[model samples]
Target chain A: MNDQEIIEQIKKGDESAIDFLYKKNYRMMVKLILKNSGTEDEAKDIYQDALVVLWQKARNPEFVLSSKISTYLYSVCLNLWRKELERKGRHTSSEGMDYGENMPYDEKERIHIVQKCINELGDACKQILIYYYYDKLSMAEIAEKMGFANADTAKTKKYKCKQELDKKIKTQYTPSDFLD
Target chain B: MELQEKIDQYLLDQLSPADKTKFEQLIAGDSHLKSEVALQQSVVTALGNTRSMQLKARMQKIPVSMASTGNALRLKWIGIATTGAVAAGLIIFFLTGTGQEKNTESAESSSIQQTTSTEISPAVVPTIESTTPSAESQTEKAEQAVVVKKQKNTGTVAPSNEIKAFDNSANFDDIENGNVTTPNAENSSAPANTLYTETNNKLSNLSVTVDNSNSKDKSYQFTGSKLTLFGDFNNKPYELLELNNKGQKNLFLSYNNEYYELVWGQMKKTPLKKVSHKETLEKLKVINP
Candidate 1:
């Protein structure tokens, strides 16, 4: 499909279009990262991240892509890899490197606990939260997708899911229980 | 619930200027509100990380890693080349006629073969007279073939129950090397009682026509796998038909309205022999219907 057709399908949240976009640009994106001294795994991660960004942006009704989709994806990958290189300190000497490279023990523990809590949530609650926060889909779109009667039903469900998740996460947040 | 929504709004940066300023002031003043917003921010961050991981995992599952993709493209090229060679061989096989007829007739037809010539007395001369190509051209068609209903005599006359399908009495030499024009070719699906059993090496390049005349224009086609030749028998459309009787396989082609038997195995060695063509084709149309 042409760029506009792929854009339209992605806007409608077509899963195949995401797969198509990912495969069609995989080699080019990977080559970019490899030429910049990134490993294959690192290249795949950066490219997938860029494609996810495209998926999230295309679903926004107000978003207008002015250039070819390939050009936009190429630019996103380039910018993202540059940031990665800077973070790794590969662009400069490591003489002034600090111990701030690793995540704090407490923060990592909290993140693990949060992921477990999210997984323990019921399917509907989990999907509603992801759709709202990560996918950034509007309430009406969620209603149609989740087969709720209307936007109000979807909103009400999101509120309940968030409250349940908060309760779940709070109950698991004792540092003494996870003192490793 | 109201406080919780405000905390979510502040964490997501979705609150307006006035609401954001008020919420920040509240966060600075109250330690509990600040901790609540911090807890919520961590949850949203983790959610994004988990989703991104899942999407990447899905992409890795898609088919054909780069290492294997190159091999698949090479294999496809090899397959195309093999098919082209097979088609070229068949075109050369049909354009040049092989050897003449050799008797592979089974015991059933041979037992009645001696009776056929004896039964063809002076009275049967009038019956054979009507067996000429001009007489049968009225009902002749290129796609039409016969079933082995008249297998009694490999020579000519059929018994009472036997149905004669071809007019085999045409002059063999005149039919083979004559100035003949082919009929309009028609193609049809192979019926349950099909005339030709596909060769283990099925000649799909059947577009080659017999070059009896000087012009190299090809009018013969195996139209849709039916072994029909759309060539001329004196301006009439002539067809080739395959007849299977008992354990024997017989292939026939026509020129000047006279049918020549194309011996199966001896194709390269056998000359084109004038034999049973019309009577067998007539029965083939009956059985196919």
Candidate 2:
């Protein structure tokens, strides 16, 4: 199908639409990265990131695609790859900044604990949390995506999921998990 | 707003700067709001990570063909380069086999260059003998002919009197216009110059070989489009050899007892750079390309 139809399917959360886009643009997008000094795995990673970005943006009702989906994906891949290369350069040059060691011990523990708590959440709650907090979707958009009755229902569910995740993490929290 | 909504607004950075400052002060005073915001921040970061992992997993599972455009483009990049020698050989091959009249006149011309010819492989020997035309019959036709003088035509260049072709562009133009005369050649009476027009049977006769073919003897042919001289002989005939060295195809011309490298131009006449370098001339002298 054409860009509009595929976009509409994505807006409707059609998995097949994602599959179609993933297959159709896979070669050219990956080839772009491969030509620009990226390895196959790196190319695949960048293209996937670009696709996810597009998929997330397509969920916004007000998001107008000013270009073809492929063009949008290509631009996204290029920018992401540039950022990735910059990150790699910085990572290589900044030898003393070991990321895990640099972070506060408690903060690292908190992230680990929070990630574990998040994993315990049901798939729907996880999707809702990601849609709102990560993808920055509005409550209404979350409601539409999660098949909630309304924005209020989506909001209540999100708050409850957060509370559940917080409770799970708080149970695991100890004096040692906090800095003095 | 409910405390949770207030906290959500602050956590999402949706609050105005003044409101955010006010909320930060309130949270600073209220440990509970501060704890809630911190908890939510960690959750957001974790959720983002989780979503990325999920999306990445899904993408990695998507099957792509191994023989996709990536490899195709790579192969195309390799295809971008064609060495100058192979290209020039192609040019010489096509330009030399154009005239039908050149084939008929081959019996006279082909034999004249044999003694001084480089090693002639069966494949490179053009089927010029297939087309035989009379010297007198092809007098007018000789002007547009493509000529090749094979090794068998060695007698055409008698060792008794050495022949020196016209050394200048004006004379080269005379040769190009078929104004040269062999005893049996009906083209010219301008002395010394012989029209050696030998046409191969098929234009598909192309070779990508080395220069060692012109190792010994003196035989050369200056015909329609190009002049190829082979072997080393006493007369030191002005012979032009299309030599493919390294990846470059260069024309090393021996004319008027001097060696010059010819650079082809858009027009009929091209400038020849004189080669006084002994090593290069000796090297060129040995190549029977």
TM-score of 2: 0.44
**lDDT per residue (tens digit) for residues A1-180 in model 1:** 345667776665555666755655565466556555666777787777777767767745656665456545655565555546565655354232222247777767677788899999998898888777766677898898899999999999999999899889878674233332
Tell me model 1's lDDT, rounded to 2 decimals: 0.50
lDDT per residue for candidate 1 within B86-171, as digits (tens), equals 44345546665553333222212222211121112212122221111011111111111112311111112212222222222333
Error of 2 at A22 (Å): 2.7
- Interface RMSD of each candidate, angstroms, one decimal: 33.8, 30.1
The lDDT for every candidate, in the order shown, is 0.50, 0.51
Whose DockQ is greatest here?
Answer: 2
